[model samples]
Target: MGNFIMGKGSRPFVMENQMLMRHGLITGATGTGKTVTLKVLAENLSEQGIQVFLADVKGDLSSLAEPLENNPDIQARLETLGVKDFVPRSYPVTLWDVYGEKGIPVRTSIAEMGPLLLSRLLGLNDTQSGIMDIAFRVADEQGWLLLDLDDLKAMLGYLSENAATFRSQYGNIAPASVGAILRSILSLEEQDGDLLIGEPALHVADLLQKPGEEGMIHILQSQKLYLKPALYSTLLLWMLSELYEELPEVGNIDKPKIVFVFDEAHLLFDDMSKALTDKIEQIIRLIRSKGVGIFFVTQSPMDIPESVLGQLGNKIQHALRAYTPKELKDVRAIAQTFRESEGLDVAEAITSLQTGQAVVSPLDPDGTPMPADIAMIYPPKSKIGTLAEERYGELMRQSPFLFKYEQRVNRESAYEMLSTRAEQLAREQEAEALRVQLEKEAKEKAKKEAKNSPRSNREGITERFTKNIAGTVGREVGRTLIRGILGSFKR
Candidate 1:
């Protein structure tokens, strides 16, 4: 495994391949070479045959598929850094988009996302979140699949209608909570969050590059997605969770199987619940054993929660402008995160860092955090910005996943199953109602016919009068016979 040079400090600052899975952070102000550092790491990892996944939030990272052309400024920097073996090259790239407009549509089923993450995505309160959990459990117990937004909506509707039925088993499912969840679903749909969930769901295995082939850099087109911060962060986290769950425990491998770069990462923690934050912290702490590495890229170190920030072994800080007292205080705190280097004031160094310069602390060869160094970031071997439209289209057409995930599959999931069950129940109720109505009508008809029958009433009166006359005559004859019989008996 070859070590990729990040830049020259006092000596060449190299990122060891074995330490890539230790996780890292890249923080800087806007336009302070965070993107460049990200590109460099991704390109180098790909060259070493490790798959990479990163979000192209600003549409800048998509050009990894295009080779960098000769630029005078880049050449001068390369000379200044005394780079011996730098080549302009492009890496294998697969483009994905939730919107399906920019690239291959990436999707995941609601079941795969589960309740906790889905609740976070929906911004649900504790009550509503509990209802969501019940909804999933109900779906699962009833053998219903929660595949898409429609499935979830159907499930929630059923829960609302049958809250009393489920209350005994799954606890109270407040109608208001269900209503809140429904409204949140509607709001998400309005934001096109529906596009993120469905069939032909993304397989975590597909994110890995095929053996004996160059590592593929999967870039999610996130410009539109970033607008909906909750969705954007949740989608990324869902992907990470999948990786952590699916990949086998390959503890401390030579290199990571995949490296994930999370851009605009502050959005992930902002307004996040403590429970979820702890979950994320745990994931970051333990996911290295799964041969996966995560790098968080953001504007400032303060944007990250301290719990998560501490998990990153490799640290890279680009410039932060500290004019205000608060900004200066933040810069100092950011500096404190790194191990102090001799003769370098990190706080002062951070504020005055040039556009391509950053203070880096990559892990040492024996898996130790190195002291901070002020180093110039190397420009990407690939093109630095968005690819040309035609080239991008061609690449999209050539993607193997395009055909696999292009069309959505909507099989009989919760929506269809619940809807069918409801229809059947309605039919049965209708049939029972009709039977009751028919029986009542038959009884009423019989009563009315009996009341209107004159022939029957006349027959009844004639029979009674005839019987009465016969009875009186027969009684006199019988009395005489009985008296004679009694005299005979006495004698």
Candidate 2:
């Protein structure tokens, strides 16, 4: 394992590879070098064969695939920090997109996402969320696979239509709640969120680099995704949850199996339900044992909940603005989060520190928080901005997993199954209706024939009496002749 130098203070600032799994936080105002710090950490981790996953909201982090070009300012900073042997190079990068426009498409099935995360993404109220849970339970019991937006939509439609049938087993499912959830689904679809739920789901193992190779940096292209705050946060949270569930426990490993960098970290907690907030807090607390480190990159520490904020062992505080009274108070609170140094007034340094300089507090080798130091951050070895369009295209073509997730797959799931059932029911109903119509037509034809036939007239009473008298006389005459003949033969 290799320890990377962060930058220079009174002494060299370094991040121990073994302590990377302890988790960390990087906070500052916009343009205060948060992105640069992210890039630097990614480069070092990749060099150490540690996989990294981060979102590129501004479309700039794609430059990790391109080598750094000549920059005088970077060279000067390296010399000032007494840094030697800094090579400009690129790392392995896999690009992903939810919309499938910029890179390989990434998707997860609706069932795999489960009801809770889907509810969060849809911004559902408690009643609506309960309906969603019932919908999922019904789908599971019926052996229907919820694989995409269409599947979920069909499930909701079925629930609405047959609420009474399901109510007995799953409880009362209100039509209004179902409608609200459907409307929420529609709203999500309008935002191109439909693309995020489907087949060919992303496997976390695919995010890891192969053995005896440099670690791969999986960058999610979030330029448009970030526009939808709820979706962006929920997607990242789902990926994190998946990692925690999938990875094996390796307590206190020399290095993390993977490092997750969540940018725009505040959006994750915005309007989050208390239950969800507690779940997230628990994941952060226990995920370290799974050899996964999560670093949250945001504008301010105050953006994070106090419970989560306390779990970060490494602290990187970039310069923050404090022009107003509220801002001053926030800065002070942010300053107090760090381990105090001997001479540095942490709060004053927070507002006065230049860009690319931050107060760093990484965990010591003994797993304890080290005192904060005002230090300069090292520049990334890769390019500082977005990758060129031509290079971006070339990299996409070269990606090994391109064909795997490029095409969307829609297997037989809840949507198709429900549709088939509905169609069959419709056909049977139509057949029964046709049978009934045919029977009625036959009866009407018989009645009409009887009314128009020659037997429509009635017989006269005299003719009916004469025919009855003639028939009786003929029978008596024949019986008398036969009796006389039999008596003569006997004599």
Candidate 3:
């Protein structure tokens, strides 16, 4: 694998592409260049012909499609960093969106999303989540494909109707719990979930495209999606899970087959259930063997769980303010995680660093952490801001997948099948009611005719006496059989 230039330190700091598959992190304060570092990493990885997938949470990352503007400040920084052969150019890029506004629509079936992530998206409590799991199980057993929101709603309704049947098999699902889950799902729909769950779902292969030496950069336009933090984070995690499941194990290749950069990574961990948290941690640890790299971009290292933090081999930390005692404690705690380097006070350097500069700790050839150094991260070769709306639209139109996922397709799924079942049941009930009414009318007419006949007095009395005697004998025999059957068994 070719060496990856991270930025400039006392010397040119390089990252081995092979080690990138090991995972990494980039953390800093709000305005201290976390996004820039993220861009830099993406640019370098793409240049090495490794596919990159990242979310443009703030919409600025879309500028990766256009070259950066040359300026005096940029030239001066390049000189200070002792860079040569630096050119302002753009890389191969693709845009996608869940809302189908900024880019091609990206969707996934509710069945593929499964219950675990959906429960997290809905913020369901333990019991409510259990009820959702039961819904999925019932759907699986019945071979229903839950492709959209209505499909899930249909499944929940069916479960409620047959709660007694499923209670022993799955669990006791309370009607109130099912109602709460349905209400939560409706609330999710109100948050634009309809655009997110549908047909022509996102294929994992689309994310791993490389047409030239520079790998394709897939940017998820998430400006509007960021409004619903849970939705955005849950979607990202779902993709990650898909990557882990779809990609085969390559076992320590020269470079990662794909590099995934998770911007605003803290949203993935916030209020996560223990079960999900454990699964995420396991994925992070094992996905490296699949030749996939995961870089989490967040504000502070503390924002990441300790188990996950241990997995990130490359660390690029930007500035952090230590104006308060608590802030200082956090800063010191973050600084201690780095390997000790002589002549570099990690804590002091952390708070003193300026924009576009970070404390770098990339892994060496032997897969060991290099001594941490305060380095100036290079500016991205791509545009520093987003592209014009027309340009963005044009680029979206040129995408090969534009035609594939453009039109919405609503095939037969759980929702339609359940609706048909309901209609059929309703018609059957109506027919049965009509038949009962006709039988009642016929019996009344026959009884009136018998009373009007001359033989009513003679035959009616004799028939009544015979029927009473037969009914009495039948009841005695039935009672004796029931008693014998009951007495035969000991409780």
Candidate 4:
């Protein structure tokens, strides 16, 4: 085989028809054609009946929604590759924002985000994660809704306030544990808490849909999200988990519901706890059943866990600089990931691959691995780099879901209800204080009147008061008055 210019010469590989929904990976160092390769694959996938989901880490992918202006190089490449009817067209693209301010609101409620995924985003270590877990469990039991970070924070606060009470039920929530866990969640809020928590979160079903006419691409911008790696990973994994929960068992299909591209995958694995890592492993393993495929785009395969790397059946490795021993080791390891080819020195080929080129070793439609081929990656139909600024905003303005998510909807969730409850409690306390003040004033006035007047007047007052209430009822009025001072008040 020669250059299988997707759509040109009937694609030498079976993927030309449709297999990307099964999933794929596009990885390379910065400045390489990772983004371009992604665009090309996205365009091709859109060409098929399937839809695509792209994480536009740098925001450049916004150009994908626009039509590609014909350039000499792209035209020449397409002609030489024998591409048939290659019309530069735009795919169905949706702009999604976790914060819901920048793009269409893509949010998942905290109730939907269970404890396992939430713990890692909090950056909780083993013990701290356990405490966080307990907080979630306690929230569920107390009829509390953990809809957002504030809800979780409230859960933590309730635990600390009633630590003595919860110790028996939840097993020892220490002051130190409380401090560590609260600090962790607070830090996350400062970083991504506001963005992660709230109403109108992402719906996994939206991602699964083929948004437009057949073969249109869907891209997600991730430039603003680089700072919150923990939140980013959690959200990404949460998406996968949601897919698993919603998608029924499809056994096997020629294509997937949607192909997920996880660019900058190293951010997800860097310094993550063992528990977090294991949870990621579980999601990646099980999500396949839901017909959702995941691809990790990183500098080297080492950035991904061995468990996850093992699960990724499709591999597209680009050039690597083998200037250092570790670099060379990484190159060799990447070579081992593919089916060994006779004419190819994959290890050597990796270091020598030209720009816009990679070792494509997709699992053939038959489920058997194809031979590693040094294929010329298809040129992206979109502009080489990000679309101009204001491009995404324009897209959002025209989006159908604009009115649905553009205007922020503040539902009466925990935050609003808690604020209301606090006000009610304050009013109740104020009324009780006023009643006590009035009673004190009456008692003092009664004593003064007794001292000024004759002793017969004080005796007459007591006799009159007793005579006034003597036949009222069998109820003990004195015990009721005493109960007000010593017993708990519900008002």
In terms of TM-score, which candidate is strongest? 3
What's the TM-score of each model vs. the native? 0.91, 0.90, 0.92, 0.83
**What is the C-alpha lDDT profile of model 2 across 428-486, one tens digit per residue?**
76666556556655755675575456663354668556755865675566556545554
Q: Which residue runs of candidate 4 sit more than 4 Å off their true CA positions?
A: 1-22, 99-102, 211-216, 416-491
For candidate 4, write residues 284-391 as lDDT tens digits: 777766666777888888888888887877778788888999888878888988998887899998888777778878877565678888776667766666676677
Of the candidates numbered 1 and 2, which has the greater TM-score value? 1
Report every candidate's CA lDDT: 0.87, 0.87, 0.88, 0.70
Error of 3 at 98 (Å): 1.2
Give Cα distance to truth, residue 197, candidate 2, Å. 1.6
Between candidates 2 and 3, name the one with more favorable lDDT. 3
Model 3, 416-438: lDDT tens per residue?
99999888877776666556556
User: Runs in model 3 with CA error above 4 Å?
Assistant: 457-491
Candidate 4 lDDT for residue 305: 80
List where candidate 2 sits over 4 angstroms from the true fold. Answer: 445-491
RMSD of each: 13.2, 13.6, 6.6, 6.1
lDDT of 1 at 178: 82
Number of backbone-clashing residue pairs for each candidate, in the order shown: 0, 0, 0, 12
Whose TM-score is higher: candidate 1's or candidate 3's?
3
Please give the distance, in angstroms, between residue 57's alpha carbon in candidate 2 and its true position after superposition: 1.2
* Count of backbone collisions in candidate 4: 12
